[model samples]
Every structure is written in structure tokens, then in C-alpha cells.
Target chain A: MEAPERLGEVVQASTDRFTAQCYRLYGAPPLGSLVRAGEREPHVYGIVSSVTTSSLDPTRPVVARGASEPTEEAIYRSNPQLERLLRTDFEAMTVGHTQDGTIHQYLAPLPPHIHAFVFRCTPDEVRAFTQRLDFLPLLVGARTPPGDEVLAACLREAASAHDQPTEFLVQAGRKLALLLGGEMQRLNTILRRLPL
Target chain B: MTGREESPEVLGPQLLGVVVGGSLSQGLEVRLEDGGVVEELKVGTFVTIRGERHRFFGMVTDLGLASADPRLPSALPDTTNPAIVRILSGTSAYATMQVTPSLVVGGEETSLLLEGPQPARSIPFHFSRAYRASQEDVQAVFGAEDERHIWIGSPLDMEDTRVCLDLAEFVKRSNGVFGKSGTGKSFLTRILLAGILQRDVAVNLVFDMHSEYGWEGGSEEGHAVKGLKQLFGSRVAVFSLDEESSRRRGLSPDYLVRIGYDQIEPQDIETLAEMLNLTQNAAQATYKLASRHGQQWLREFLALEGREELAALADQLGEHQQTIESLRRRLDRLNRMAFLVERSPEDSVRRILEYLDRGTHVVLEFGRYGSDLSAYLLVANLLTRRIHDSYVRRKEQSLGDRAKEPRPLVITIEEAHRFLNPQVAGLTIFGTIAREMRKYNVTLLVVDQRPSGIDEEVLSQVGTRITCLLDNERDIEAVLTGASGARELRQVLARLEPKQQALIFGHALPMPVVVRTREYGPRTYAEFGFREQAELAREAEKDLKDLFG
Candidate 1:
């Protein structure tokens, strides 16, 4: 498969103007571009979603950043090991001064798949998958708007894979997907209007 | 002038205004104030003006205020306002003394005097500050600022401190919480757990039917996930139905149990057996077969190679074929009951016993488990057995040295009414625990919303009751009756709000307190929900993509 164009490099050519323009439109690049500078992994870019100052320790501040979806999942999966690194990265991005304090931030990676469906799996299947990876493929839209549809579709697909997808699962997923799409559109619209 | 000094003989009848029949003295006419002659003072307007004291204390019986001449010279003008003076009757010394020296009827300066001791000072029946446990005191005892430790929101108030308890004494031996839905019963449950955990002294064994307490502050992606593990460490063990753990061993699926037709007390059992394809004779023989083969006898009995083998065995047993056939039929019936029973592992039972033996805080997280009812019953039974065994062992050693041994463990069962059903088995293992555990130092903290649903005998055995607000009158009444000193508990219950609990009876507390539950650290079941964690993870993933990609 052909690799996508180096969009980052193409965008970087006009960094000053772009930065100035972006600052004028939205505020500061709330997150500093560490990856853009080639200091960190070139493929990885951290976006500062929020900067929270520490009330307990003035020196320690929290910077919430977005990570790639895979990276975020990894963080969750290996939480015990990654906590300090994420905390440090978050603090470095957000913290202006250092004092004895704690910082909190989420390192979420961009999702590889934009839309994924979730469905109920048999206990045996759930066990099989869960045991293999020590992590379950969580159903994202199990409760929310798109979640229900995605979950329904996922269940239907799973059932069909076994040649016995229940009619309920099939229909439920299709209907749920429509509902979920509408919810997603609404959420997107809301996010677009927000300052972030 | 004294009446004794004035002789009636000296003043003859003629002079005394009696002067034979119709005397002039009797015919004397008196002009009324309103220019109308009246025989006696008006009922409401009667006033006896004391000339000596120049004061009047009497009712303005009629509408004399409007009718009285405005131009008439008023006697004691400041005191003649009828609105300010109420008409007084039933004149006794007590009433008269209230008016005091201000009013004197005769020229001799007569005054009513009070002679006896004054009545004791009346104090309104307000709750004494000493008796009323304040939110601050409760917070001090139970509240922790850490998100992992606190159950209620910040800025704790009286609502956060409402505790329910019986009125018999300062400590409640046992109490429960029961509500239909959305009555904040779960919130109250969390508060109680948080309170106990905050003390850091008591070890809690929370059988979480619904995985509420296992996760406290950390979401699946963030703090709670890891925070829970760190905070609870070995103290908390989550036994989900989906997986086998050291603590989740030994739960037998109800279907696997051989049900004898003779053992079927109710028609429901017979129907259930029939639904499972067991003939009456087979059902009757099930008990004998199971007892002789031991507990796992059903599994071995079901493992008979084929129908041919089973038939051959039936022939070999000849006279016992009826019983064997019954057993075989009942085995088929058990398939339907598979969901109800869980085949408990020996290891899980041993692990729990180990915890009890070592006196460690163990929370069996059965929230994710499929068969909750069976899991709870099994754990309850296993714990009871271990407790009994330990007690027996300790008793044998205690005749020589009673004072030196460690006390038995205390078990806290959240949502206790679910397992301790009196209607089902007459006395559930939980009831047995309540009855027998006290002697072994194995205390039970039974938590539930419907206090009435719990077995009355078991409820009676509870020594410390910490109650929250209960809306159901029947539940309140049951709690009041079951708990000692519960007469005054209603007052506390009436005032309880969400998260507020009355600690009437407990070893540590003196009086019932409206207490804000302490903040629980991130390691409690209340904070953990698998679905919630998944959602958080999804959100985190999305945020990462938006920022980086």
C-alpha cells in the first residue's frame, strides 16, 4: 500500500504564517508542538487539550493532550507502567513553573478506525479474546447514541459470522447506527462551536 | 377594720339595711354608667376598679369601647384601653398573683399573695447539642478528602450526614437499607461502606452483587483503574463470574445438584423437576445416589458413557433400577437449572478461608459474574463453615488459654437481603452466620434497603445498626421492632436525606449522628463499572486522534 503524503512537512513549510493565523483564529497552540520539532517521535504529535495548574503544588501543572488511538489504548492497557510517563509528559506540556504538586492528563491516541461496531459476544468467545490479549475489545457505543447502533451492527455481524445472527441483533444495529450517526453529527457540531 | 372587732349586735338589724320587710335600703336605685339600669355587671365588660391601688383587672365584657362616652374623664387613661386588657375569670390566688399589687379591690390595700415553691423552669424539648452528632464530627470520624475515600460530593452538609439507627441505645447492633428504585439507597450503601473503610480499623468483606464498590476514583483509562489496585491491594478481591480466581472457586451451578423427589417440599420444585425431564421415581432416588457418591456425585453419575451403558447399569442394579432410573431422569432435568448454579472451585473456598484465617480484608467482587445468587450462597456457606471450623478449633485450644487467641473475623454483606431469604430455606446460611458468628467473634454487617425482607431472627441478632433514610413505613417499622432502642429511631429516619445516615447503634459511636460519609479512595467498587471504563477509554482514544492525527 502506498504511504500517505507527508502532510506534516507540507504544512510545516509555512509554519510561521500558519502559526500566526491559527493563533489569531483559535488562541495559542494550547499544546506546544514537541513532535513537530522532531524532538519526540516524528510520527507522534501531542495536542494540548487543556492546561490545569496545581493547587497543591504550584510547580506541578497538568496538561491534557491527545495521543494516537493506538497509543491511548496502550496507555490504558499498561496503565501501571505508563502512568508516570504520561503524567510527566502532561506536566512538561502544560506546566510553566515547577512546585511540589501533582498533574493529571489523558494521553489518547487517534483512533485507527473512525467507526467501529460493538456487540455482545458469547461467554466463551469473550473469554477467548479477553484471555488472548489480556484486554477485551470494548464495545464503544454500547450506551450512547452511535454506540447502540454500532454495538447492534457489531452483534449482527458477529452473529452472521457464526451463521446464526439473531434477527433482533441485525435490525437493532441498523436502527442504532442511524440514531448514533445523528448523535455524532450533533456532537461534532457542538464541538466545532466550542472554544477548544 | 377587722371583722372580729365589729360586733353584729352593736349594729342592729335596722341599721344593717335589713329594716323589717320592704325597707327603703332595699329600694335604693343605682344609676348605670350608660344611662341604662342593669342588675349586674355585663359578662364581658365587668371591671372591678380598686380604689386603693387605682388599678382595674377585669374584662370589658360588652362593646363598651365604642359605646363609652369619648368625652368622659377616664380613670387611669393609660390602663383603660380594652384591647390591651383581657377579661379575667376564675380568680384564684395563682391568677390573682399574676396581676399582683397593681390591682387592689378594697380600700384596705388587699393583694393576692403567692406562697408555694415556684414551678421548675421549663426547657423546650430540643435535641441537646451533646446528643446530636454534627456533620463536622462525623466527617472527622469517617470523612476523607481523597476521592477514593469520599462517597458524597464536596462541601459536606447535613444531608451528607444523615444516619439511621434504632433508639434503644447509642449503638445499633444491626440495621439495613431498602428502597424500590432511585431512592438513593445505593448512594446510602456506598456512604456506609465508605464510613467503615475510612475508620481504617475494621476489615470489610463486601460481597458486591452489583460491582459498585470495587472501583473508586479511577476510570478505566485514567486514575481509578490503577488507583483501585494500589489502594485496595490484597485487601480487596473481585470475584467475577466470568473468570475463576483464588476467591471465586467452589460455586456449583444449581443444575448440577441432584434433586430427590422425596426432598421436594413445594409444588414448584416438582414442577421444576418435571420441566427438567426427571420422573418422580428418579427424583426420589436422586438424594440417596448423591449422598452415597458424595458432592461431585452428580458429575460422575452424568458421565455414564452412553444410553446403552446406562441401560446395562440399570439391569445390573436390578431391584435398584427404579432408583437408578430416577437419578438418570433427574440428571437430565438439571440442565435447565445450569444458569442458577455455579460449580465452585475448591481453591476459591480455600483462599477465602485463608483470608479469614489470616484476618485480611477480602471483598468478593461478584458484580461481573453471571450467576450472582449462587455465587453469594456458596460464599456465604463456605465462610460459615470456615468460621465454624475455626471456632471449633479455637474452642478446643481455648480451654487452656482463652485470653491470648485472636478473635474471629467480621463479615460485611452488602445487599444482604438478596441471600438471607427466610421464606426460601426457613433460615439461610446468612441467618445462621448472624446467630452463630457472635460467639466466634465473626460479626456480620448486613446491608440492604428492605430491612423487612431480611430474616427476623437474623435481624434480631444484629447488635449494631447504622440506618439511613427509609421511605417505606413497613421497613421503618420492621427496623424499629428488630433493633433495640428504636423508638427514637423514627425521628432520625424522618430527617434522613440522601447520603445522610443515623448511627444509632455501633461500638464506636455514642449517639445517632447525621454524618457525611468520608470520601473513598479510588479503590472502591463504587467507582468501577466495566462499561464506564470502556466509554472512558473510547473517549480518551478519540481525544488522542483529534490532537495527534
Candidate 2:
């Protein structure tokens, strides 16, 4: 099998979430995308919840310099040193972990170690991981500010990995309706955002 | 309209759901499966539950919509979106049906085959799967068409599956056919009578008040419907009280029934007192005059024209003068009836008894007299009294010899409440037969629209009650009296279609069933083995020639 492409390295970790810093500037995976850390057993999986591009060091605040340039690309092209000062990183809520070749759609026993390699999951891996919807409640109950939107986007992203995306979204929407019982407003918002 | 081909899979019974909670008295509550659409499941339809130890059969009496959360109604989902509607239907909101389990067959196939179905005394275990009853389940419960079973109709939505009646058990006791006017009560009664004659379980003596059961009757659509005589040929004998009226209807009645003044006993007066508007004292005075004037009391009394002669006779009999005067006034109406002669040459009661004794079913058509309730009450009371007496004497003589026991007689009476009301139910012979309940090998098939007017005691004794749509609360209550699970059956009974549908429950069927009553057209006529009139005449002529040659 081909090796999954590496995207970042885990810079900060916790029992329920982890922060991964991209190797290249502005190279963070899109929000709500599935990504995992660790190259061997006990792979930790999560959904990308948010992304940031800021100074590598907290004390050094980067200043904007594109006002005098004719175009934004020209400003970036003129400032080669800016790439060394800025870094892109994303925060993902830990949704599941794998052990013994069996995927467990729940919190890992221990957080991923810092500096562990993180890779964006392949379409086949995404489909296999989402074969069962047990991990839906984790995404729905996340502490993210726009939790329903994040959950909807994650479903849309996972749906494309399946042969029949509409059927997959409908199944996921029904499960959300059940989990969000009496929360019709939340369910309606999520269903409206579904690709179907 | 949708080009939907009705495949067997779609028409056949599909899995409904599981029995969630219920009791034997209130019926089981079934939570519908996701595939079961609530609108598709109708009330009064048949359902079968596969319990662990038994296969329970029942009717869907009620339907409901429920949700896992009580706030679903106020917090409604987006219904315009088909995806949202589909998703929220079965998961967050679900449908439920209340099933009244009536009969249960055993778990083992061998046991079910040997023992048949029995009343469901206990409920199925929780979560037992309930389904739309299949044709095989219906056949298993209500046996196949055979010598002893008659196909009465098909259950609602199960047009291809026949729900039969046990003819042998049906004739064992008096049954009733009740509904509001114009609800096909007459047609349903005809079907039952035809079935009884076809099965030969018992011989029926019908007092056809409307002249419908003797020859042909017109349906609501003005179509001619055949009567029992036309269907049964030689097995049925038609007796008409109005020969001219029968002839006008193209009927050749076998016998003309004429009641004599002497045959009009004082008891017959008591039965007709309500219909004739006779006062209690006026009705009671007939007995005094009968004892004083002897066998020709009615004829002798009607001869007293002037008030002075009546007063003198009333004083002689020690009755009040005014009471005698009013009694004479009421008895005078009988003189206008052409069927009531001064003295009849032939005994109509004895003729009817002879026909009944020979296993020939008799239908006495009242013809034009059917409009006059008093004439009907008098003749029916007189003839039934004598026939019942003879049956009692014969039944006693054949106590040990079953073969000699008189054939079971089911007397069909229309406008039955007039004879079976509380005032005269005890005094009338029809009421006596209903109460005695086949003791003398005689039963009644009481057909009426106003069951509430019938004596409650008599109504309770009716074995099987097949009723059409009855909007009157009292009538529905009266028909459901003394029935087990009457509360659930009340809902089913009230919802019956105004025509060509009936709720049949009681001694004849294993469970209560709502049926689209079998069509009473050419198909049913063929089923009853009816031959053309010319063919019957030809056969009769052939028999006569062979006998002489």
C-alpha cells in the first residue's frame, strides 16, 4: 500500500484534542477534514475544528506589509524572511483512536505524544472509519463554538468518500435528529447545511 | 393513477412492528417499524402477532402518533424537506396501533392443526412482532370453505382472503343482523339465510315482511336481487299472505296463508297491543270475551254492532262497558284485512309446520300487509306459537333418539323489536324462543334496525350479532351488550361503512372481524347453486313424466 501523505507534527496534545503545526507555511489542512497522528499502532484520529496563521514565537507579532505592493503575491514574494517568522497550525478535537487494527470511535487512553507525525486520512481510510456512525455524538457534543456547522462539514467531507454520498448524508442527518432530540433548531440548522 | 403495479409483495401482509406494552383488557400497543407508514394502517383491519408460544390474531381497533420526546409537537422539524421528513419520522416520531388480540393458535404447527384457534386470554410477551394478517393466517383462523364453514365475507383490505362463518355453530342459537335503515341490512340477512340453506345446518322459517325473501327484491340501485326461493329451488317454499301483491311482483307463491278469526287468540292481541294503540284494559278485555264466547270469540264479538248490545255483553262478562267498546273498536281493524277471514278453510300454522318438518325452508311474505305492523304481529305470533308448541312436544318424545330429534329451526323475523320489546318480549312466542335458546331445537334470527328497542334480556341472549353501521349510540350499545372486549369493539362497530360492511363477533366466529360483506350479485348466486327458472320447470316436468310412465 502507498504511504499516507504527512501534513504536520503534533505540537500540543490533550486527552480530547491536539494542536498540529504544519511543516510549511500556510499548509494546514482545511477545517473539518479528518487527520490522524502516529505512524504505527494506537493512531489518534480527529476532525480539524479550527486553523491559525501567526508568529512562531508569541513575543514576535508579525506586521502587515502588503499595502504598498501592487498585488498580495508580490508582497509575499518580496518578504522571504516572513515565512521563517509565521507558521500555520490547526486544532482538531480527538474523536477516536485505533488499536489492534480495530478502530475505536472514542477518546484515546492517552493523548498523542508531542512531535508525532500527523497525516490527512485517505478517502478509503475515511470511508472505513465512518462505516459506523458511533463517532457522531463526539463531533456533535464538541466544545467548538460552531459545533453544528463543524459536524455538518465533517459529514459532507466524509460523505464524498462513500460511493453514494446522498444516502450517507441522509443516514447521518437522521442520527443527528435522534441525538439532538428536542433541539429542533440545532437539528434544522445542521440538516440545512447537508449536501443533500 | 401512479402506474403502480400491485405486486404480491406490496399487497401481502408486511411486518408492522413489535408489541411494546399492553394488557389483555385494553389490547396490546404496537410501535410501528420504520417501513410501516401510519397512514397506510387503517382502523378495523386484521393483524397477527407472532408470540413466542402462540400466534395471536386480532383487529386494529385504534391508531396513534407518539414521540420519544414529548416536546416534538411544539419543536416541529422542517417538513417541507423530504430528507428532514424522512429522517424524523420513525426515529424521533413513530406510529402506534392498538391491537385487541382475540384468538391464538399454538406454537407448534401440529398443535395448531389439531386444536385450532382459541380465545386469547393472555397477552403476547412484550416486543412480539405484529404483522398485517396474511391470507394463510386468515385461513388458519376462519377455516377454509367446506361443508361446515360458509364464506361470509373478506376482512377489510384483505379482499382475496375469505373470512368464513362456522355454519354449525351459527345456527345453534339465535343470531341478529342490525343496522340503521338503508345500510344493506336486508342484503346481509339474505346472505346469512342463503348460507344456512346451502350448508343444511338448519331449516329457516323467515317472516319476510318486505316481500323480498320470497321472490326478487330491488337493491338500492334499483337492480333486481334474487330471493331464497329462486336460489334454493325445491328446498324453499314461499307462502304469501297477499297473493295479488305476490303475483304483481311476478312471484308464484306455493301457499296462500289466511288467518281465521278463531286463530286470532287473545295472546296475539297482547303482542299487537302496542302496534294497534290498544289500551291495557282494552287488550285485557279480549281474554274475558274469549273465555265467555268460546272458540269463535273474535267473530262473535265483532258481530255486536250497537253500544247497548256491547254494554249488555260487557256486563254479562263482568268487564267494563268502555273497555269492551274500545276492544271492539280495535278488533274491528282486523275485519278490513282480507287475509283474516271469518273462518279459514286451511290451517296456515299446520301447513308451515308440515313444510318445516320435511326440511323445506319456509319464507312467509307479508306482501302489502308488510306496511301494517299489526297484521304482521298477529299472524307471526299465531303461527310461531303453534310451531313452537309442536317442536316442544316432538323434542320431548325424541329425548333419547337423536335421529328423531326435530331438525333445528331458525325462524327469521324482521322488524323484530316490535315483537321483542320489553312490554311484550315475555308475552310473545318470539321472545320465548330467544330466551329458551334452542331447548326445543328452535332458534331465532332477529333482523332489525332498532336493536335498542328490543328487550335487553333478549338482546343479551343473541348468540352472534353481525351489525352494519349504526350511528345511534343506544343501538350500538345494545348490540355490544354482554360481549367480551366490548369497549374496543365499540370503536370498530361504529366505524363500519354505511353499506356492504359488518362487524361479526360472538359465538359463530373465533374473533371479532370487520368484513367487506360478500357481494350479493351473480357471483354469490352461482356460489349458492342457483339454477335458472326454466331449468327448474323442465326438471319438474321430467320428474312428473317419469313417475307416470
Candidate 3:
């Protein structure tokens, strides 16, 4: 397949998978349902698992999985294919079982891709994701563009998860968000200038 | 025209020339329409033509007239006089003459050039002459007529002008009058005194050496003697070299103690010892003894000692024995010359102590006693001691009050060179006075004809100096060294005439000025109008001869 065709297919499958996982874990529709209803824009709800892969590799896929619910441990077991993919690609992993009996797991390969995704998520969306999940996955390596956005979202979620309102956590969250945004911008610039 | 020999005497107003060969020569002589020939054409002389004045002052380098009508008269004026026309064409008119003409006559009327008087080569004394100073020049040199400080003499504009110092600044630093004998130094000195005493603020203390000022106040011929006495009152005290008076008030042993002999070096004490025939050890012992037990101790020590012991102590001085002996001899001479009775050393010292306690300007008349160096030294030391005591007492008071009230005292030493010899070991009095006196408001006004004879160190420390007609080059150089603005002072000193001309240079004078001295007041001296005792015998013989005849 041509590179653009493959990239488009990957993006579509990731969006669908994230939507399904988010709905299963939260007992609610995907964040995109809100965008469809004109309440907000499409946003991801996931945990940062592992980050690996080069930002310059066009063939290398940027992957992440939605967090799981605590009550849905059986569901994670049923999704053997997804779990296997997460285990192979992710440098780290996190599983979440929500109170609604829905299981979810998140996996990210290519730190740049995770950073890009976190950079794109708003603070409110990150906060909402953190409220639905118990454990958050820590990003292990650098990523670019949508991966950076994903990392920023995860950091903001982690900060919101703290019991106490700490200046250090808030400041850290802000710095991580800025770093992710800068990385995404650098990756986008590089990609745009490519001869292809 | 007188004759045709002189080329027809240059007739008519126009000269008609004819072309001959390749040149145009005179064709015909044109006559004036008035039927007259032009006579003389002087350049500066005025001429009337057509009822308008025209000056004939330039040469006719070229003359021609162009006219369409041949009938018009072509006669030109004659130009011959050398004064009138410049043959060379570049000669300028005399500056006295006013007329200057341009070559192109453009119908402009020439100004009426009147000749002005020529400038004189030299200015004369009178205002009518060119040499006279203008009113502005007079004001610039002499200042305004109403100026208070400057005094304008009669014939004030002349170079013989005299400028009296403003008394205000003059009195701040006292003036000095000095000159060689027969130089009228004394005459000028008296004149300065007269002028100074006229001021309300003037206070003078004159050291009368020749008794000239003394006779002025009594039955004497000098004027203003009574006025001076009234001015100073009891402040002035005159000490004559009359045997009794000199002996009574001369420098005594107690005076040295009172003046603080503790400050005097052992050399001086040794000299004093030799003068009194005391042993070297005795002199040193006496000095130390005096320092501890005061003047009374010296008297007691001398009374208990034998003459042989004193002589042995003087011998023990060894190398300094001569100096010590000379000093002892000087002290002995002081006792005799001053006419003070030879008393015990203690009694003499006590007298000095008493005199110093009373602050009086003591003028010691050394003339009667003759020129005795020891007498001069003794008197000087006595006066110095008195002055030192007063200064120390006042200084102590001032210091006690944290320097609240300062008493300024000045000691004017006449014939200062005699006492301020650099060779003398104990002559530190002068150096001490120069360096330390200012702190106690005590100043030394040293008057001497030869400033070079004094110690250079002491001379250098003199903040103010009044230089009279110093004839010696060394003296002049010495004065110059102590003087501020030395270059100007040297110039003034070089031009100073004998007597009246003196270059007063120092902090006291604004600028060195040559000044004439003022006359002394009659009251400055006590025995006024008395002839000298030497002249009295001669006068008596002349009187007896006249009576017998």
C-alpha cells in the first residue's frame, strides 16, 4: 500500500479502537460522541503505557490503548489480540478496571507519537480521563506530534489525580504540556518539509 | 600767456591733435567758448565751472572728447602743477587732504574735502596738546575722583603721582622704614607715622634708636608727640640705657626661668654657666636644677658654691668653653651696659619675672650705652622672654577654653639680625617664634636692613615681609625668597629709589607697591625738643663766646 493510504487506515483503526475501549471502560460513549452532539471536539481518553520508536520513521506506527475498568478484568482477558499487540509494541504498560465493570488497557509505541497526542488533548479532557481511571501509565521515551499530545494529556490527568493540590505537580504538568507541544511542532515541521 | 616759448602756455580747455603719418598729433588748439585760456591746474586747488566747485587733484593721463557736433568747444583745462597732478599716477594724496577722486566721473558731486590738522609726533603735558591723557585715561590710571583708598597728589596726572596705601589694609600688617645713613630713611619714617596715626584705627609702637622721636613729645620740636601719648596712654614704656634704669629692668636669671628655661638646650645653659664662671657640670646641674627648683634654685646653688668650683665647671665645658665664656662675659657686660646694679643671679631673675608679668612695649635705648653686642642680646632676650610668657599664658587660656578667645600679639624686633644669628646655638628663640607663635596668635615682625644676616630657616617661615630699600643683592635675594610674587617684587625693588621707595611684598600687601613713609607723631617720643647731650656742650661754648663778646 502507498504510505498515505496506510497512514489513513492506521488513524481510522486507532480512532475506532479508542472509541470502543473508552465506551467499555467508562460505560459511556467515546469522547467523540460529545463532539458529534456539538458539546466538544473529539478527544482521546487513554493511559500512557510505553513510548518507543523514532519520530523520523514514517513506517513506524504510533500506538496507544484506552484505559480499562477494574470490573471488566474478564473483558481484557477476552481481548487477547489487543493485549498481545500492546505487549509487543509498548515499552511500558498500564491496565485500568473502572467501577462500571469495564476493562481497559493502554499501549503506546513511539514516545513522539504519545507526546503529540497528549499535546492535542485539553486540560478538561485529561482531567475527565483521570477521573474515570485508577492507575496511569508513565511514558518511557521521547515521541513526536500526536504522541507528544497524548503524553501532555496523561501528565495533566496524573496531576489531577493527586489528593492534594500541589504547586509542584501543577508546574510539572505545565512544563510537560509545553515540551509535548514543542516536540509536536518540531515533528510536524520536519514531516511537512519531506520531499514526498 | 606770457610767451610762445613755453608751448603757448597751454591755452584753451581742449587740445586738438592731428593725425600725421601713422600717428594722430595735435591738429589745432581749441579755445574756451568764454574766450579765455586755462591758466594753472593745481590738484588740491578748488575751481569753479558752471557754478559748481570741482577740485583739481588728479592727473590727466589721457584726455579726449567725442561729440557729433563739431561746433561744440573741445578746449580742455591745463594740468601742470606737481602739487595738483600726480605725474607717476600712483602717488597718494597727503593724509591732511580730504579729496580723493575716481577716474570715471558719473555726475556725482564730489564732497567738500576740507583738510584736517595733522597728527603731532609727540604728546605734550597740557590737555590742549595731543600728548595730554584723555579723560578716560585719567580715570583708568588714577581711578575715579571719589575713590576712598587712592590719594591723588597735586599735578596728579603727572608721573610724579603718589598713591598712599589704603590705611585699612596697611595697618593689618605693620609697615617698616629702612635705608642707609643720610638716605632720609628717618625722615620718611616720621612722615609715614604721621599719616598712619591720623587714622582712627591706627596704633603704633615706634622703637626710637637715635632719640630723634623721643624729644618730639616734650619740650621738643617734633609735632603730634602729645597725640601719640594720648593714643597709646600707659601701653608704651620707654627704657633708657641710663645706668640705673638698665640695671633695674635688664634680662635677669629669673626671667629665663619664667620664660621656661626647661625648653632651652644645654648648650645655652653652658654658655650661661661660663658667663657666670660656673663649672660645666655646675651649668648642666644648674639648668637641670633650675628646671626642677625654678629660678630660686639657681640663686641658692650659686650662693653655696665657691668661685674655684665655678671656674672648674666652666673649664670642664672643654670644646664649648670659649662659647660658654663668651656668653658669661656677655651677661656680665649686659649688667654693666644696662646700668643695672650687679646683684645675685636670683635677684636679677626675679626682676625679669616681674617685668614680664606686666605687658608693656619696652623700648631699650642702647645708644647712650654705646654699641654693645651683649647689651643688645640681653635686651632682646629680656623682651623675647616677656613676649614668650604672655603668649604662653594666653595660649594656655585659649586651650583651656577650647580656643574660644584668641589674643593676637605681634613682637616687632628692631635691628633683628643682631639677635637672630644662625651661628648661635641658643638662637632657637627666633625659630621657635616663627614656627610656634602663630598658634598662640604671636607673630614676629623682624626689622633689619640685611635680611640675609638672619637664619634662612627663620626667614623662610616669615609669612609677611616688608622690604625697604635693600641695597645688597644678598639681602634682596633673601627678601625675594620670603616674599610672595617674587618677580613683580624684584621689578619693584630694582626701581626703588632711596628713602621713600620701598617694595612692600608679602601676604599683607595686595601687590608690592613703592610707597613713601609717613612722618612720626611728636607724642611717640617722651623727651621732645631736647638736643643731643653731645651737642649741648658745643652749644654752651658758642653761647658763652657770644655772651662775652
- Name the top DockQ candidate: 2
What are the lDDT scores of the predictions, listed in order?
Answer: 0.37, 0.88, 0.36
Candidate 3, B247-270: lDDT as tens digits: 453422111211222223343444
Sorted by lDDT (best first), the order is 2, 1, 3
Per-residue CA lDDT of candidate 2, range B526-547, in tens? 8888977787799999999999
Q: lDDT winner among the candidates? A: 2
* Superior by TM-score: candidate 2 or candidate 3: 2
Model 2 DockQ class: acceptable
Per-residue alpha-carbon lDDT of candidate 2 for residues A1-196, written as tens digits (9 for 90 to 100) = 5567798899999999999999999888878889999988799999998899999999988887988999988988999888888999998889899989989999999999999999999888989988888888898888569777779889889999999988788788777777987677677778888867
DockQ of each: 0.00, 0.38, 0.00
Q: Which ten residues in a row have the lowest lDDT in candidate 2 chain B?
A: B1-10
Flag regions of model 1 displaced more than 4 Å: A1-196, B1-202, B216-230, B239-241, B244-287, B301-346, B402-407, B424-427, B484-488, B491-495, B498-508, B519-549
In angstroms, the error of model 1 at A151 is 85
Q: Chain B alone: TM-score in each candidate?
A: 0.50, 0.93, 0.50
